[model samples]
Target: MTANDRTKSTGSTDRTGSTSSAGTPGRPLTGRRPLAIVAAAAALAATALTATPAQARPAHASPPTALYTPPANPDAGRQILDLVRHRKLADAAGVLAMTATPQAVWYGGGTPDEVRASVRQTVVDAARHHALPVLALYDIPGRDCSQYSAGGAADTPQYEAWIDAVRAGIGSLPATVVLEPDSLALLPSDCGQDDARGSRTAERYTEIHYAVDALEPLAGTKVYLDAGHSGWHSVNDIVPRLLAGGVGDATGFFLNVSNYRSDSELAWYGKLISSCLSYVSAGGAAADCPNQWWAVNDAQAWLDAHVHAAPSAMKHFVTDTSRNGQGPWTPPSGVYSDPQDWCNPPGRGTGARPTLDTGDPLADAELWVKIPGESDGQCTRGTPGPNDPERGYQDPPAGKWFPQQALELVHNADPRLVP
Candidate 1:
């Protein structure tokens, strides 16, 4: 299915009165007095004032020379704006703060010329502010196991043409392209979406390889392939896939793109994957490299004994802090046959702000690869009914603005999204 097809199938009106589309989307923090919450909300409202939208910058005024802030999807700011109009300043502040932070712009469906024009506009906009835009190229064939957010190019040829268009749109401009989330982690074979001949899986690899080759050589482009998250795909399992998909040719891999794994877990997972990739490149077997499940001391010790490459020599990675502040959710045991913990779990919050100055050597930067306020599709939580059993309401479809979850993310933001 293409993005339009998915949108047509699952499209519905979100709380903000917008039609849902194909995309990745997110919850809140915990204990606090009512007064403290109110005061923090006010502080956040004040902070939003300082985060001027990218377009507001004068043609020559140098904005923060950092991650590119794309134009707001109406859903992103609508909740905040509505709350502000209602004099719900506290709630408005939370939503404002969430939207104010820079997030990645996703492109999953378009004709070659259409995608080219769209991408060109984004890159040009970023160039105006001297910012590096994070572009997520998600139109791989057979994406998302045909589940929520299921959509991509119809086939390899079309996909390649789309990539060429993206490259043309980029045109030697600086950008960090997150190439095809889940393209590697959730292959067609993994979801039984492939045939006996495994043609789809082979094509999947070919497509990703093509994307890496197409985008990595750009003069100012840095491309990162997806590696799922710490919660899934051990270092051994993911390393081989990354290798197959040409991680060596790309900038590196990204972890927790649209999941809720904690920062500590993701960092350790990234380090292990980086170390293992280095070890493999040096003729060490991936199976021999310690995985994330190993005890910390033992894993480090294994790397010490088997991997001598400096951190600079290893593959670097970025993590999604978009909605990991509260980490992964744990549903009540024995309640649902499938928890769908990743799909719009309640009480999650935004993670660390996007930044390239990560102190870790092998970790390139932390990014909000997933938009913070969009829905992860309607999370049924194993029920036959439409409503999520846990939340008692039908969640918005993927890529739609989810106002309740947006507020939760604000309230629960780790490091506290306060003034």
Candidate 2:
């Protein structure tokens, strides 16, 4: 059944004033606090101003040569501009930092306040340099489908407040906010089996709608709701969820935020949903939406014929390029032993440099939604220490690198790393 049908049939209440608590389930170190504290401490240290003679500089020091310039393509440039304007300087920095070797920095770990401040400052700095900023919002409750990185605001209310702080931080700035990754499609509403399903469903809608309501209206900000990879949810299944979660308010929906689905696959999936959305908005039954089953040989051609350069009403989408160059890894046998592939699958390498150009009119921008180099989470593979093979622990999941894995990719890409 369509998500809308499911919602209506379930008789879920309207999520008007529902709110979540600040506390999240799981370990204390799991959420954004540790990172926030670290950032706060760093800010404090930077402010002390008791620098060594060499570190001190004149207030009038010339701004560093505009470190980043938006790419020539409008879509790509717009993504860059959004990042710069919104104060995502470090993210902006990643566009260049990974030029030599593919890498990116994920920035949501810090405290809500500190992260908000850092993003604000980053935008201010980027504006000074005539650049744009791109921001990624990944803290959806039950994030990562409630896996290792699975902590979020205790409930929806707290999440709304946290989102408000983030929105306030971007006050009056031009930015692109890639809303909660995998929050829409990868939700656990269905995972709870018999008893827990009801509450999980309510929580999912509450959080999604709250986020859209809070972020979509921010001036100069474009919020793209996350749609899972092409392989996951069908168009019929995802579109209604988008609607319930306020897709109408969002700029558009984002696809393949952190997964390895190919551009061709993502484009197809995106267009399919976009069409379904058009039908739904027109008062058509989502279940009867035949567009969902349409076949196509070329995603670009399909998009070319049907998709708009930008949606008539909503904002638009932005995708990630953090680690999809080679697509998904298929294990010869049991890879994760339990569906751990979502964490940090083996043999995967970095993808294209994060850019905004999707080469399709309907696609708003392409970005590095996944911050490369950050740990996805600990896994069972190689040694525990920095890619040490003797320990046989693997790299942390997702953006992290197992030194050995990194070396393999580097050597494969350019024989230099193999000495």
Candidate 3:
């Protein structure tokens, strides 16, 4: 509900990694054979293509890099194990297909020493595989607006020490770090949790800036700040936050983490934000930037006329396609007082597989920022009862796996997970 709950559900939890032997850091880990076949098909297709005029839009500007694939979550593993025990080999294979794809490893709460040890082991394991790991760092103070996926450090100093431990664990390993998913979008001031003096909001920014400063400086770590998603913050609204949160120094910002925004929407929005960031850095006003709310042609025209920075000159972004295969869920009008659309909506499927080959210059990758099949917390839908009326059952907490949801994601996967 709060721009993709990054923390493990109220109490749920999830790991580390090392450098290249994995090929190149962040490269797609969908197996070398599959990649080769796809490349051959693409090459064959390219031979028959006709030339077209270059439009003023974001195009693939960088070669694709590799992304690490951490082990599947316990739920996925358990599901597979049970299926195997029952001789449900086909079903077991199907679930394996769902979990085999590259996804982020989330880390929310842990003691400094514990986190450091865990992260160190993770990076080391990644190094052994010759892959690059994606880390979802989500232990900020006042996280999740203190909702279902609540809990973070008690205060700023404690938060800083935790971050310091994370840095120590990462060391000089090649990694892609997605810093605090909702850190920017759901500030204390916006949640009515800040004081009259806005001390909490100020502290939030300070924490974010501290993280960017700390993690971005590591030789092999590329740190990305949170910018919510296309549906939440407009280019104008989030650009200033990114700037304030140290996007200038970090590896740009990430979009759609743990949310369900479509690929096309995310691409367009990311381009606009990247272009606007450039425009603002060049002395243009944030309000003057073209926004996603504008008509498509109008926005494109605005960009052509006002922004001139190359993709290489602007900050790059990544998107969460983890569970947006069917786009957003639209509950029946006037059904429940609150639809809780973002909270474990039914029939939603996994989107694109994690890949650095996004083909859009501004989009660095389409990542599974939210592990597939993880619950978004129990949804009451404004009812007094504990069960979600939509599902007629109590949903699992934020980070726990739901077997039904897992199969739903597989069955409805946009490109078909098992075929």
**Each candidate's clash count:** 10, 32, 14
Clashes of 1: 10
Q: Candidate 2: lDDT of 306?
A: 47
lDDT of 1: 0.75
For each candidate, give its TM-score against the true structure: 0.86, 0.66, 0.84
lDDT (10s digit) by residue, model 3, range 1-419: 22373222222111111000001111222443544434432332232143121222221223226676666666567665655555444445555776767788778989999888778777666655556678889888988778767788899999999999999998877678999888887788777789999999999999999999999999778889888777777789889999988899988999877777789988898889998999999999888998889999999999999889889889999888888888877768998876666677777788898887878888878888788767777777668859877777777777777777776776667988765
Which residue runs does candidate 2 get wrong by more than 4 Å?
1-112, 193-197, 290-294, 297-315, 333-339, 380-391, 397-402, 408-419
lDDT (0-100) at residue 178 of candidate 1? 87
Q: List model 2 lDDT by residue over 168-212, tens digit each.
A: 776766567767665666556644421444677667777877877
Clashing pairs in 1: 25-374, 27-348, 27-408, 27-409, 28-347, 28-348, 28-408, 28-412, 29-411, 29-412
Order of models, best lDDT first:
1, 3, 2
Give residue 418's error in model 1 in angstroms: 2.4
Cα lDDT of candidate 3 equals 0.73
In model 3, how large is the Cα lDDT of residue 133? 75
- Which segments of model 3 are wrong by more than 4 Å? 1-65, 85-89
